[model samples]
Target: MTANREIDSILQRAADGGRITPEEALLLYTEAPFHALGEAADTVRRRRHPDGIVTYLIDRNINYTNVCVTACKFCAFFRAPKHKEGWSHPMEEILNRCGEAVDLGATQVMLQGGHHPDYGVEYYENLFSSVKQAYPQLAIHSIGPSEILHMAKVSGVSIEDAVLRIKAAGLDSIAGAGAEMLPDRPRKAIAPLKESGARWLEVMAVAHRNGLSSTATMMMGTGETHEERIEHIRMIRDVQDLAVERGYRDDAVETGQEIGGFRAFIPWTYQPENNHLKGRTQATTMEYLRFLAMSRLFFDNVSHLQASWLTTGKDVGQLSLHLGVDDLGSIMLEENVISSAGARHRSNLHELIWMIRTADRIPAQRDTLYKHLAVHYTPEDDPTDERVVSHFSSIAMPGGGAGRKQLPVVGVS
Candidate 1:
């Protein structure tokens, strides 16, 4: 309860822009009164963004392939090499997907996929370059450290080389796609085949130094302990600190939006629907709310925090705004990875705006770097031209599509 001396002291300290220790964060996460904790986090949010505008991204998550070498137990989206469901989407389909994204008002595309054995750095070099050539307006925010590592190894090049080549090929930034859990226990339990947590941080550090910014992410409820969860954010906060010291640029110093390093921290609850783990463990709504509050208070240096409506559902996603979330990631014209794992929440442009409005926050469309593209302060100001991506569109679930086609698996609830 907030009446408790320790809770009151810690919450006030955090809300006042002071950093909380992992021990203090863990205590608050487990024992603080729900409303009081959320209110404190909201206070922090107000301090960071007094504008009271909630931002959303208009983007699609388009995968280029589904064949992956790392068989993470928690992933329901990957297929083994040459499996009947495995695919490397043709260049035409990739271009078509991007074209669709642009027509639907997308300013960015998250181009990610399985780490296919055959996809080296050159593969991405060509894919990214081709996409940029076709859609120069769409910012390409894609891939994580693991995928980059796989690509680098497959290409017989170093991590730095692979990153540099991709940047040249039009990778505007890196996506925090594969950062499931930063601590060793959860990473080992859920994604043993994936790269180490330390190495993951190293790759992001490399991206930051190379002038390619990225967001930090965590997938909770994958059977890790409470201490491990707190430790995960601690690890992220530490890396963020390191990134600022080593890679910070003053590109947007006037606006206080640091140009490089980790720009946002997005924590989403893991989907256990059809994965190997089989839903043995899950994070409750209560657990998730606590994480939202704790993360905002813990990451004073990170500029933004995002709520994952795609996985947590819209109601919880809306509730997150009061608990320190400033952003709802995207409408995601096409998403395969999490949807294949059982995330069914979908939104249209107007419905998403209404969600933000009903939450008593100004709804704004934002670019990749958190800049407001358009701020809708009143209903009349809302854009009527934006459209929605159907949840039951032509995309098919894994194995449901026609034979060996190189395309994405549409999520079926």
Candidate 2:
């Protein structure tokens, strides 16, 4: 354990807006008092967001295909190409899900899937163009460095060229879906077929340079050491520093306009169930909150930190609002990736607003760019839209019938 005075000194410096080093973060993550770490993180959160408003997004996850070539052992969502079980969502079904998202008041759609050997840039271009032509209102915040690299390799184009092509084809931004862990040891173990950590960061920088901002993510409890976890955050922060230096992002974004870098940092625990990991290791609730708080202190350059209710339970997600998180992520109207890996938590619109209000903060609906579109002030005024709910359907379901059009009721009593 760290000396009491030393930990206090570190927390005080961090809470006072002084940047803490990787060594200090490691000390706090492994040895500091749990509640004290949370308190320091809460102080920083309040300083950043003085308003008592917590934000959420009305979005859906649409996986176009499950046929993949880059087999990551940690993922239960992907099926090998040409396997009888592997299936791609027909274009009609993809568009139908978008129509459902529009009816449910979704502002963003996350399109990610397996790296099918047959899918090239043309496939994504056609998919994104069709989504845009049908629903121009929805921001196509889809895919990440992994998919980009796969598509580029298939099309024999450079990564930069691929990003630009997709942007023109209607991709507004990229999600942090594929960023499981950014360090070498853990990432290589989980995704040996995937790119290296440096290559992943290089692709994100490529996107930023092309004016497509994205969110950063880290998946904890994948057999990563405590020191390796800090390394992930440090790598992302270093890239953010480069973005600020190159004028891709401002030093401080007081206004809502974005200049194209990582807008938020979301760290979620790895769910090990049917996957190859087999639940041998997972992050406990205590570790998650500590790391969440530590991330808030470390990501001084990133703007938002989102709470992952779907992976962690709702109670912990709510507690995160006090610790460091300013956002509760999406209601995730339809999610199959993590669900396929044994993550079972789910929520709806009413529950989300109530979760925020009960935490003594107002709940606001934000767009993909972190711009507030609507804010719920009183319980009497919360939208009674039953359509904004998740079915908690996993990709491992019997078939591709996840009930997209059905509006499930969330009981308040």
Candidate 3:
């Protein structure tokens, strides 16, 4: 009864918009009933959004190059710099992909890639400049702190200079990739060569200070502890608090213009298929849902929380709406990194709308900045565009044909 009372008090405080400590969050995450936790999280979600709308984005993950120097063990996408299969997409190919995305009503393109040794700040400047010059409509939400650190070192420039040059060269925003686990233990175990978690936050702090807004992400199920999970949230919350304290909130009260800060938090599970870190423990569906609820309840300052349907499958994605997920990540036209790691879940715009509606919420299409572009209230108002389908890539199967398929076991060479 005493434990129950503690849990109830924590739930009440969280649902009422009061802040809960990391210890309270862990208790709710580990001890509270699943339905109760989800209910509290849903209440918090409704309070934050207030409009019964679940949002999604229309975007494509365009990996520029596969050649990488820091080959993390949890990755199945990167190839060594000297590998024969290591190839960088040419400028024309990238532009063609952008054209395809634009034609399909996509307003954002995630230009992620490996950290090539020779690619310096100038390479990214030219790439961003050319992309913006060709398609000014497409938002280049690309790169992460890891890439920035590497590029700065390679180009012999400071981190601030690297961020400023990229932003000036039309790099609209940064993607919070490479933040697998913020804690040092698990992070080093999986990605020893990557920048430390504190360093990652430092880089993001610099970006936020320089007017570059970005999303924050956490890669779970990578052999991390419950305490570590809570610590991750704590770290993010502290940084977010700092961002606000430094006058980097979503809106400038004086000018009414947007400023730099984290716009959303996305938590995805680690895929353990063809990577070097295979045969490790993974997060179950229930654990994922629990974390989802806890994140919603804990991240009071963060505005949006996205559901990773790409990693956790479609059913859980739908259920996440009830567990405090306001956004169902994206209708990814192409995703190679997660797919290469055995994530086979895919969805089209139509299916996503149906999923959201089935969850008893309105469906809305949002842009990179979480601005709604279109809202579907009823079936009569549903979009009729058939081209918005998940068609480009599929999980690697034994035979041919790339239909809606499951992941097949491919041996790591």
Cα displacement (Å) at residue 344, model 2:
0.8
Residue pairs in candidate 1 whose N, alpha carbon or C atoms collide under 3 angstroms = 396-410
- What does candidate 3's lDDT look like per residue over 4-106, in tens digits? 8889899989999999999999999999998889999999999988889999988878888999999999999999999998989899988888888888888
Sorted on TM-score, highest at the top, how do the candidates line up?
A: 2, 3, 1
Candidate 2: tens digits of C-alpha lDDT, residues 196-283: 8889999999999888888999998888999999999999999998887777763224554445889999999999977888878889
Top TM-score model: 2
What TM-score should be assigned to candidate 2? 0.95
Off by over 4 Å in 3: 1-3, 251-255, 391-413
TM-scores of all models?
0.93, 0.95, 0.94
Off by over 4 Å in 1: 247-258, 390-413
lDDT of model 1 at position 378: 98
Candidate 1 Cα deviation (angstroms), residue 274: 2.1
Taken over the whole model, the C-alpha lDDT of each candidate is 0.84, 0.86, 0.86
Where does the lowest 10-residue lDDT sum fall in candidate 3?
Answer: 404-413
